[model samples]
Target: MSRSGGRWADETIHRIMSMTKPVTGVALMMLHEEGRWRLDDPVARHIPQFADLAVATADGGRAPLARPMLMRDLVTSTAGFSMIVPLHIPLTGLVRSVPVAELYRTLDLQGGSLSRMVERLASAPLAYQPGTDFEYGVTHDLQGHLIEVLSGQTLDDFFAERIFRPLGMADTGFELDAAQRARLSTVYAWGPDGLAPSPPSVTTTDGSRGSYPSAGGGLYSTLDDYLKFARMLADGGRAGGQRLLSPASVRLMTSSLLPAGVRQHFGQRLDGLGYGVGVGVVEDPARATAMDAGYGRGTYYWTGWLGSWWWNDPASDLTVIGVTQQEGAAMAHVGLPQPGADLRALSAALVYGALMQP
Candidate 1:
């Protein structure tokens, strides 16, 4: 018996959707360690295409940007990139409209490479002024492009040679081989009666590599493989006997990257947590909701669009990762309640109850 009938074997590979964001953050942090760029640097300084980004006005018109987007904005997901909040709260008052989100889908940027995505995205106005608000759109995918530009390699190549290979996450990547594809778990949606197989996702990977590697939500990883990555974060960015990032950098990545006056709520009473580089930082644990679920105040974590979850707690020195392979709420732009959202709260309660210590 398992959460999804026959559950994923320990070695089974599953697509770890937005969970990919933190990995992208780690990759960018690697560049940060090399001093490739600074946090306050204007994103246009690196990705020149975004230099003239416009802001979409409510009346269907465009306006000049009030301020330039920064590297910090990208890291914090406040770059005004028309966040994709599906059943997601705490969005930009500007670009978080149904039309803009639909606009992102209309562009079908996922079908093309990040470079092309950049060219087209630059033509459209941002949902809001950079750094003014938080919207969780293509910031990580943009980070993927930034990684490619800084490292002068394709996103896949850089991830392979740097993070995955170094961490011994052999089976994880944007694309899967035939054997790995065989193990890719099927996603399900809860229907009226019970669980039903989900329709094929456009973001679903084929057996071959893709030109448009989604840094935000495109990576197939096994439980063991993702755990290796999580353990590395818990170990201060060291694994496989290699030092990937400094403890200071890890702190920066996990600390609250949001500017003041930005809402941190994610619906479902998740207001206590704050957004970090590519994950959620457990800030102000005194507040209730998912913010306090990590069992420690400084714990940092994130999850996938489908059904994978993970958290790294510095206080307790613990890392928890689980996959359920359910994909419904994310695909439903209507913001349907995530069928499994409550399970996380329950699971966390049970896990912390057993811990018996902070």
Candidate 2:
């Protein structure tokens, strides 16, 4: 995983990894705006390959799904998709090995085309009954395939036409051009020995193309470009005099959608937080273990694998972006926080703590 060498600047491009999820969510919601699907619609309705979806049992057996995997489950990350990956994340169950997840790894399901990925995903059993638990996994990749299905365009094309183009995010795309490649920063990882530069596992191909337009964790962007996006959702989905989603859609995206039993999986760093369509919602500051958690309710945020982060405070119309070319979620042998733990809570405390006094 080697990255091109460059010094970061205001225009320096980054592989803003998991942050791409919310953008994919926006694309799907746009299709929803077009009346293409319903929240409760069975995922099988669109992808019949999941018609016979199954769940895994502790005793090494498969059971029928408790209910159909719903579209909302995909958005909220409770869709029961397996979360196993080669690298380690700090969350529980995310790196756990199970038969279904093992299937995912053995097949290298993420390394292929979206259509093939979905077909393989449908063949594996879910980690739990749909909506019963939350494990950040391959569900959003399914959303990428869903977008392709409903929009009749490739994921990259759809993003450009409906999102990046509409918002004038000229610097965001799944692939980098020759100029962009030169501007991309060399990524680093924090180790017990201290910070060290490392080659990224992903990069632009053929100077302007990428192998995977993965909805789950793939996109290159700049802070200036993504701020335009975050502000749009914060301002009720309107940017540059065009509305990509209605106010209602924005609410659904920012409001906490995680259920009581499931949110605990977010673990301690994100205590009192809830998930809303690929972002984390601040539902209860009091419940947060961090002393500095001061975000207003409905402030939703997300971070990237390489420490790229953003949050939108709709209350005050404030949006913040932070970028570090370091691995936010290290391989976990040294037990670093996933997505730069304490980065958001501490930042919110300082920023909001000042505003309240003034």
TM-score quality measure for candidate 2: 0.89
- Each candidate's TM vs. the true structure? 0.89, 0.89
Candidate 2: worst 10 consecutive residues by lDDT? 330-339
**Candidate 1 structure, TM-score to reference:** 0.89
Instruction: Write the residue-wise lDDT of candidate 2 on 64-98 in tens digits.
Output: 98788898888898888877465443334343335
What local lDDT does model 2 show for residue 316? Answer: 62
lDDT of each: 0.76, 0.74
Q: Which residue window of length 10 is worst by lDDT in model 1? A: 328-337
1-358: candidate 1 lDDT, tens digit per residue: 1223455588677778888999999998999989999999999999999888888888998889787888999888888887555433433442455556667766766667888989878877787787777676678888999999999999899989998988888999988877777777777766687777765553345445566888898888888999988888888888868988988998999988888877443332245677888988787677735444546887787877676678888888888887777763332222335554454556676777788666
**Candidate 2 Cα misplacement greater than 4 A, ranges:** 1-7, 87-97, 200-210, 264-270, 289-291, 329-342
